[model samples]
Target: MFGPEGPSLRELAVQALSSVEHGYDLLAPKFDRTPFRTSGRVLDAVARALAPLGPFDDGLDLCCGTGAGVRVLAGLCRRAAVGVDFSAGMLDVARHQVRAADGPAIGWVRGDARALPFTAAFDLVVSFGAFGHFLPRELPGLFARVHSVLRPGGRFAFPLPAPAPASDPLFWTLLGFDAVMRVRNALWWPRFVMYYRTFRLGTVSAELARAGFTTELRALPEFGRRADGSPRVRLVVATKPTTQQGS
Candidate 1:
């Protein structure tokens, strides 16, 4: 769903046909007006979940998009907050839009998430709604990049909602969306690469472990629980080890 300020159907179709970076560039101007931007409620929930574990230093927002996650980092990190994304257009919008009045100084860098342009410079890293762009096979490298950027004992965190049950319409909707994306990728030139079903908790945890992170899951109580009494949403906090270990 989009607002009056959001991209039109024709504009969306055009974006769908373009490569991921270029598509996001085209959408950057109106990204905040669309459902694609991470919601304020979700941002607040993640911030609340991360607050206790922090007193963090510098923070990096991987694949920061229009810089929503950077806003969260600004409040939590004591030093500086940096947002990195491949899309120059998105970074431009973020530079103009996101501002921290008093907390941390904010900076923007344009770089690929797979080959992030940083070392162990960050005490915390956060990402929001950007994983679906990465294929399942890319998880290891992606996690590794996040790990590389973090200082020892640093955290890479993001919120993940519980998968919908089979009986729920949302489940089918996501399934259908993934199915359509598969077909589109198969038929199109530059694949859009957004899928709803690929990222799973079990797989992600294992990958995080392989990438040298000790992972933790903290339930976001604001979203409540499912009928089965499991959390409706969780914040995945993957911490880089304080000491070196054989990979």
Candidate 2:
């Protein structure tokens, strides 16, 4: 629906009718062509912001999806960069998309984010545009999963845009989309779960805190400030405490 190479409307309809996992599996090959892939501009801004926070040894890109975030990791991290996703097709694209000069070796692992397979292995972790696939109730478990993979004092980060107000057309557009998806799920099996408004800042911060990470938001100046002077984009930086033992 985005460009000549992007999926057509009929193909999108077929995807929307499938379960979330299966839908992504079906869409994986052309996913990067669609507008859904995180943009190069956003990726560059994120990498620039994260550079000061690094010298990180290893980094992981959760729900990597065609390796957009993996590129960011390859630039920020020194030793290795890994991309994890459930779709093999997506991983295939990532394997090819991530061939830059000499840097951390790029690795792709096919796995679900809810049950990641690692323990204190990554010094930094990042995700982009995949949160809507996760329902709010899953945040605790998901955050815990991320926590288990990060080294102590390591940060799990992502960029979050401020919610659109009711006055904005984007607000109603997202609301309508969520409502339609709910109806689609009610009539369909193996539900697809993606909602725009579900993961607000307050709920996310609380979940991160519950999962044992102290979280903060860092504004990305590259995206520029909004009309009211608030940042257009902010990075949610959640840090696992240095001492894992009971405080």
Candidate 3:
């Protein structure tokens, strides 16, 4: 249990045994109370980093679980802010939880991220803390879908923490957790595809480039630097170029 209101062990086990969508659906109500939700620190840091580039008219929060990142989108976009996710339960919770107090008119849509139901519609898009559900092989298609939904010169942004060093205990913990997940999925019926170590920046950058994004990494200075002086976390700002190659 993470806190007084967090899901109990039995609830977590039941959800974990279910498919990814179902699991999230079951967790929707208590998701913010759990550690799985993106932290306010990260959201605030991202909002600050993105503010200069925005005054954007339209924005999308991809895989917008319970609408955490929608709060960030609302701050930057002027006219419309949309949150899209496949889990109807999650969207239902989001609809009630988030309100358009200011910034932009907010809306929630139920849809799959791999096959998003929009094209060149948004000037900006962001996702937070949901990449682990996607496998390494899915990056190309996922990035392509994000690209397709963005208007020319639109930006797809997300925060990526630096991988824990090999000597760090967190590194081994994630490695072991991923191993356990592999074994569990092998033995289970509905596989829960959440692996923390699969999305490496090198592979992700290459995939984004392949999907027609020009990628840039902006330091999230609020999180500070590591021992090596590299940023503890960096925001990946991958843009869909305004001009076509042949044009």
Whole-model lDDT per candidate? 0.94, 0.90, 0.94
Please list the residue runs of candidate 3 whose C-alpha ends up more than 4 Å from where it truly belongs after superposition. none
What TM value does model 2 have? 0.96
Estimate, for each residue in 58-165, the C-alpha lDDT of model 3 and write its tens digit.
Answer: 999999999999988888999999999999889999999889995699998899999999979999999998899999989999999999999999999999999999
What are the per-residue Cα lDDT tens digits for candidate 1 across 103-209?
99999999999999898999999999999999999999999989998999999999999999999999999999999888989999889989978889999999999
Model 2 poorest ten-residue lDDT run: 92-101
Considering TM-score, where higher is better, how would the candidates rank from best to worst? 3, 1, 2
TM-score of each: 0.97, 0.96, 0.98
RMSD of each: 1.3, 1.3, 0.9
lDDT of 3: 0.94
Candidate 2: give its CA RMSD in angstroms.
Answer: 1.3
Using lDDT as the measure, name the better of candidate 1 and candidate 2. 1
lDDT for model 2, please: 0.90
| 10-48: candidate 2 lDDT, tens digit per residue | 989888988876788789889988978898888888888
